[model samples]
Target: MSTFLTLLRRDCAQLLLGGRRGGALLPVLFFLAVAMLYPFAVGPDAPLLARTGGGVIWVAALLAAILPLDRLIEPDLELGLFDQFALRGISEEGVVAVRVLAHWLSFGPPLMLAALPASALVGIDGAQLRLIEWGLLAGTPGLAALGVLVAAITAGLRGGAALGGLLVIPLAVPLLVFGAGSLSAGGEAGLALTGAVSLVLLAITPFAGAAAIKSSRG
Candidate 1:
């Protein structure tokens, strides 16, 4: 029990402090950048911007998810952290579970906060902002879980970061569909579907991540 807490603590430390490639800030910055730039590219048509903003946010969030992929599992593997956990009789699944939680902590809230400013930039109002928030809440878990799974799978491969990013896009299409769909449709069904997908991914991530790590090690 203590070990699990310790691992979780360490994972949090890595996210909040020890970030190798870029800290937790990178993804948030990327997300905001995307939101900020779209107004310039598409021209300042208010209704058009408001109408398309939700989907833009969804796509930005999705790409933000990809930012941490290369650093996700490979750094821990390269540092022999997993080996130490194995030596201590700790299950890789537990480590991966902790990692998932930590990753979400680093990725989710900041993006949500950034979305407020992003919402303003893209001409989204309070009501649409609320939908975006709800949709992100329901969907980001799935994104985080998917990111971890893809990271584990591609950790040791050549050009794995790029590949991982590409791989996650298709896997995350469900999230994008339901989450973005909720914006215009204003229906609970989309949020429910998004939550369901998130739950399934979260349930399976620990085991799937563990297996991927093991196979990559072999």
Candidate 2:
């Protein structure tokens, strides 16, 4: 438990202070602002806003998710923390898990908070707002897992941003499809199933990322 707290503290320090000023918050805010812009760009037709809402939110979420992977593995690799953890008694699996928790806290919650206003702008229903929140809650762990895996795979690459998106976006398609599809369908069972699928994706991503990271690191 202490180790977990230590890892969270370490990650927060890096996010809040280690990079360029406002390192973590900047990307999150950028996504929020961009999401807000879409309604204006598309004009104020109600149907259009409602139709585009889910896609806008999902795509913006995906883009926002991309920003963090740039620094994800680099910090540990540069600071020798990765090797230190491996040497000291932390399993790579444990390290990855803790980092995911930290990453989610730093990135995911802020993105979700930012989503609230955008959700309103996009004309999401109250029930749909809850569904979107649930989908995001369940789905974002997968995003984090994908980030760690891609960050590990592109650990030493200069073009990691390009590579990370290439690797992650395709994998995230199901999340977008089902997430948006649920709200479009507008049935109780549809929403419930969508949330269920999202939970399944969350369940699957960590193990897959864990396998990928172990393979890449080993």
Candidate 3:
């Protein structure tokens, strides 16, 4: 228990504090850039911005989630940290689970906060912003899990980071659909589905990521 907490704290610091892997701020900046540029790209059509802003936020969040994938598992693997954990009788699954939580912490809540200004930039109202916040809260865990899982699978491969980013987009379509769809009328069901998909991905990620890490050792 102590070791787990310690590792969790270490990872959260590494990811959030802007080590060589970059910090949580990179994704937040990218997210805001998207929001800020989107209005210009489409011109000053307020209704259009309001109507489409939630989906844009969802897409931005998805892309922002991808930015940190290369650093998530590969850096530790390169440092032989996983081996050290193994020597100490810690399972890969446990490490990966801790990492997922840390990764989510590094970006998820920050994105939720960033969304407030982003909402203004994109012309979404208070009601729509509330739904967007709920969607992000329910869905970002799945994004984090997916990012870690993909990073573990592609670790040690040539050009793995780019490959991981590509893989994340396609694999994350379900979360994207339900998350963005939740902005529409009769959208509570979409929120439920988003949470359900998030739960499934969270459930599967630890074991799948552990297996991927083990296989990469061969």
| Candidate 1 lowest-lDDT run of ten | 14-23
**Every model's TM-score:** 0.97, 0.85, 0.99
Superposed model 1: Cα runs more than 4 Å off:
none
- Per-residue alpha-carbon lDDT of model 2 for 1-218, expressed as tens digits? 78768887887777645456465687677777777798889888878887778778878887787787877776677677767776777666666767677677777787788778888877877877877777777667767766776776777668876888788888778766766666665543544555565566556555665565556555
Report lDDT (Cα) of residue 119, candidate 1.
94
Pick the TM-score winner.
Answer: 3
lDDT on C-alpha atoms for all candidate structures: 0.91, 0.71, 0.95
- How many collisions per candidate? 0, 0, 0
lDDT of 3 by residue, 59-173 (tens): 9999999999989999899999998888989999999999999999999999999999999999999999999999999999999999999999999999999999999999999
TM-score of 2: 0.85
Worst 10 residues of 2 by lDDT: 186-195
Residue 62 in model 1: shift from native, Å? 0.5
Candidate 2 CA-lDDT value: 0.71
- Candidate 2 residue runs with Cα over 4 Å from true position: 16-21, 186-218
Model 1 C-alpha lDDT per residue in residues 43-78, reported as the tens digit of each score: 999999999998999999999999988888998898
